[model samples]
Target: MRYALMTLIAVSLAGCTRAPAPVADVVAVVSASLPSDPADAAWNAAPEHVAKLLLQDLVEPRLQAVSTPDVRVRAFTAGQEIALRLEWPDATINDLPAAGRFNDACAVQVPLKPAAAVPDPQMGMAGNGVAISFWRADWQATVKGRGDTIREIYPNALIDHYPFDAPSLEKGSAAQQKMATEYAPAEGAGNRRGGARTTAVEDLIAEGPGTLHPAPAAISRGSGVRTPTGWAVVITRPLPDGLSPTSPSQIAFAVWEGSKQESGARKMRTGWIPISIREDQP
Candidate 1:
């Protein structure tokens, strides 16, 4: 009995000595200067650190888990702006938008209030809403040309004459504006009041799972570049006022793989992750 007790104690001690898993450090390094447009070189020059994140499949509405499970994130801040760089491996680039087709996309979610309690990572909760800045591959195409135009997507197709493109400039503008509203209702009725614009990313705010609403694009902006193996995306916005250098904040992320036909409730996502703002480096 004495020997058995001694062995048990030794085993317990061994178990206690096991080291915990290493925690990933994610910080938004402060910079004296940051470019308005984040090019590859700009991100490379900025002091950055990466965090490894694992995303679980959200299978409530449907089974949508085609995206890669691994995600890497880096970030930096300069002046009043903060930029987050997210990269993940994807075997294919799915930007084509057609019947039953979807686009590859990624999003970054941040709480509206700097110190607010963590809301639902899916979006947010009631008054604890989070700002979601979503970047889609299909949308990026529009930034370069008239992506929605039939001629742009389908060059081989024969000439298409629309009644809207009449000889009269005023009449043509009006017709096009009217068509824009019918095509994109989410853009609201205000788009008709002005000339059309090529929208890039989607800016939204959600209080809960189904409370997502379009937010002003002026709040957040993002850009992305596709690589051979995957995608590298940058999401940038002005820092929230009253945020202190050492204040601890939280950010969450989600990804959609169009090649896997992932959409809606079906995707891979991570819960809120703690982040801090570091003092600016000279």
Candidate 2:
């Protein structure tokens, strides 16, 4: 669901001054811009068929909601189990039970058991409607300098949210999968890349100690975890939409280990993306 613009900044450049930034500052900004090699300017530019490249520096992505196919969730729960067998539609994505999750939210739950008989046409049945793929990521940036502890917080911003992308079920188009075992398909293509590509930092943080100003390995001043490696810079002017760790666009994504896009996975073409996941669930 794309958000409505809050305000429009109409700036007419009557007079502009381009001052040279500090050498260190310039290097840092340039480094952030290049997730690949510093020499590669190809980062962030879209492919030929792609009209424009909406580059994004993703932080983390999580599944919010999913669309179920051929089931009426509300009707099923409300209806009494008359013990009559009814035919189920082709697919069902139940909201399984979650420990810390709110009860108000629908999740997959344990199947109601009785005599443990096979689902026969003579037994009662219910299902949720067309499934949904709620793919989302919270793109973020950190604020540094002054009293603004780079460890404390980011002075970054995020994009306008939009509706979940609904892929057509028309067969022979595209397929998406999740990292969890239960979500595996009977047959599919490609190895498990897992969700989206997340940024890496541990090594980059180590790289910082010998180069430029270095920060602590691990510092906890308040509620957030701060590792010094300069900033894991990701361009955020435009973010890839609709893809999650599950349904991420198959094009290209950058993975940041600790501070920079090094250490794990492939090097980013340029630009930061929220493709990878932190074990703590970013």
Candidate 1, RMSD to the unseen true structure: 10.9
Local error of candidate 2 at residue 47 (angstroms): 2.7
Error of 2 at 238 (Å): 25
lDDT of 1 by residue, 1-282 (tens): 999999999999987634223236456778776544534665554444344444443335754333567567767788778888778888887876777878888888888775435777777888888888888877776665534665555678786565445455355476676764565665555532112335556778888876777785657777777777788888887775434476767778888888888766666777877767778532
The prediction achieving the highest lDDT against the true structure is 1
lDDT of 1: 0.68
lDDT of 1 at 282: 28
Please write out the lDDT profile of model 2 over residues 55-167, one tens digit for every residue.
12222231122211111110000011100001112122211112321101111111122223311111113421111111111111111112312222334534343122224
Best by the TM-score measure? 1
Task: Please give each candidate's TM-score.
Answer: 0.76, 0.14
Whole-model alpha-carbon lDDT for candidate 2: 0.19
What is residue 31's positional error in candidate 1, in angstroms? Answer: 1.0
* Residue 13 of model 2, lDDT score: 34
Candidate 1 local lDDT, residue 43: 58
